[model samples]
Target: MAKVHAEAQKEQILNAAARLFIEKGFGGASMQEIAEALGMTRTAVYYYFKNKDEILTALVEEVTLRARRLSSRATSEANTDPKEWLRTLVHQHTMLILSHHNEFRVVDRTEQQLPERAYRANEEAKRAVLSNFTAAIEAGVKVGVFRVVDAKVTAFTMIGMCSWPAFWYKPDGPKSAEEIADTIAELAVQSVIRPARRQLKSAGDVSEALALLREDLDHLSLMIEKQPKSG
Candidate 1:
């Protein structure tokens, strides 16, 4: 019970720090401010985290590790449908951002504040996540489902689209996270899909189409000419 309570307290401290960081940025927020937010003494806050940097590191590492695990799992599921895989990836990422909006905002806005080793570790995890997205897109292209010019570029674009919500999402907003996720996923898939081909028309058919278009344009011009001229 003591162990569980200790863990809970640590989580509470992290949550308070994340909120403060989101409000004031990692550089702007101080340990005393975080402690005050939690209604705890500065020393008590220090008991869980030695300083503001430690709290930021913990939050960034936690989210990065979660993302890495999710991407690794998605990569391992080799037989998953490409479209479904992309949808699941976007949905899961959006859900993660929504659940940890404050942590994500801090990570996104204050990555430069992380310690050297922590920054490198976070970058490695992010690369792995990008790898999974690239692989999923490549699979879709190979199966002739996606029409991307470059899988890596498209993967980055889709990731940017999905991650942008972390900076702006509000819990009290009109749309739920799931709804936003669905819309993003659909847009991502559609962005890479090939457009349907139009039916082939022979020379005679093309001439007839052009003639019909000219007739319509001439009628519209006549209608415009008949309208009273404005002074």
Candidate 2:
């Protein structure tokens, strides 16, 4: 019963903190406000988290863990095609952002708000995601499928393309999350792997080629999941 109550209180505080932070910015929001929001005293809030920085740290840890989980599940599946695996990666990455939209907002905006260790941990997760992207690009390049570009930068850009929607995406508005994700995936394919160089003449060829790329992406996700667990 104690553990359950604590868990419920933790969620209450996190939800309250997310709302306050979004409304008042990280530094502007205080432990007092958070505690009041939860109908508790400041000491109660401090019992679960010592300071505002702890809340910020918790937010990053939560989403990075979700992203890591997505990669783990996709990678563990038995598949060898790089294109298909990459598509899965794209979808998984998009899903993570969409499913945890509130946490995503907190993470996207408040990461710099964390202390050095927390910030480094957040960057480490990001690096793992990008490293997966770089590996996918390299695998495709070796297969004569994805062209040789600056894999590191391109990988980072690809992630930005997919991740930006979480910032301004609205569920009942212009486009659905899945629609944007598919479009981003398509654009990423074109940007990272040029069709002109493939020596393939038709759109069908592009589709077929990417289908084969999925395996490499899946492998990349698996590698990231195996990292020192964060969050």
Candidate 3:
């Protein structure tokens, strides 16, 4: 497992660099500081990453690669149903941000400092992700599954909403990442789903009524599960 060990060590270096980049801007953080953070010599750090720029590039590449994979998986899972597709996208995106908040924050804070290659790759990945959201919203509108709204605007808003948690999510918080993801997914779906579709009492047919009731129950169950218990 030499390769596995090597990969793990590389990840350790990336993680340390991300933390330093978040605390100090990319320019402010140096290779020596990163090495010190990881209890490694400057030479050891160079073995993994040639320099601070290379480390930042690695971090950006890792984040973009994961985003691309996430979009592919979400699209494959709900190709036909725009509502399901959007929900899946939101959940996955939120989970990704929560899991890699430091990396995400560093990238955001140092956008101008990113290497040309890394910046280009990141923008491409972001455009693809946005396309997924926009296409899903448009499909939902076409099928009358969602209300009439600007798909691009909604996509941008939802994306911003999902990314906001990266600034404040806490690993030791009361809610787990999965729980927060579910909550955000539900909110995103609700925002686009037609008003009649959301209200159980207003459902026009028995099947529609049942579906709405089920969704409501699922959301209610999640809320109850998240409640703080009395001593």
- Candidate 1: tens digits of C-alpha lDDT, residues 1-231: 999998888888888888887787777888899888878999988888887778878887668878889878877875746878887787788788787878877787788878888788889999998999999899887766777559888889988888888789998999998898889988988888665233232234767677878988999999999999987
Using lDDT as the yardstick, the better of models 1 and 3 is 3
Highest TM-score scorer: 3
lDDT of 3 at 33: 94
| Model 3 misplaced stretches (Cα beyond 4 Å) | 196-231
lDDT of 2 by residue, 89-183 (tens): 77779866765667778877887667898888888887777777777777766665677788888877877776777687767878777887787
lDDT of 3 by residue, 91-188 (tens): 99999899888988887777788889888988888898888888889988888889889999999999987888988999999999999999999999
Query: How accurate locally is residue 129 in candidate 2, as Cα lDDT from 0 to 100?
Result: 78
Which candidate ranks first by lDDT, i.e. highest?
Answer: 3
Q: What lDDT does each candidate get?
A: 0.82, 0.76, 0.86
Clashes of each: 0, 14, 0
Off by over 4 Å in 1: 1-4, 195-231
TM-scores for every candidate against the unseen true structure = 0.78, 0.69, 0.83
Off by over 4 Å in 2: 1-9, 35-47, 72-78, 193-231
TM-score (C-alpha, index-matched) for candidate 2? 0.69
lDDT of 3 at 148: 88
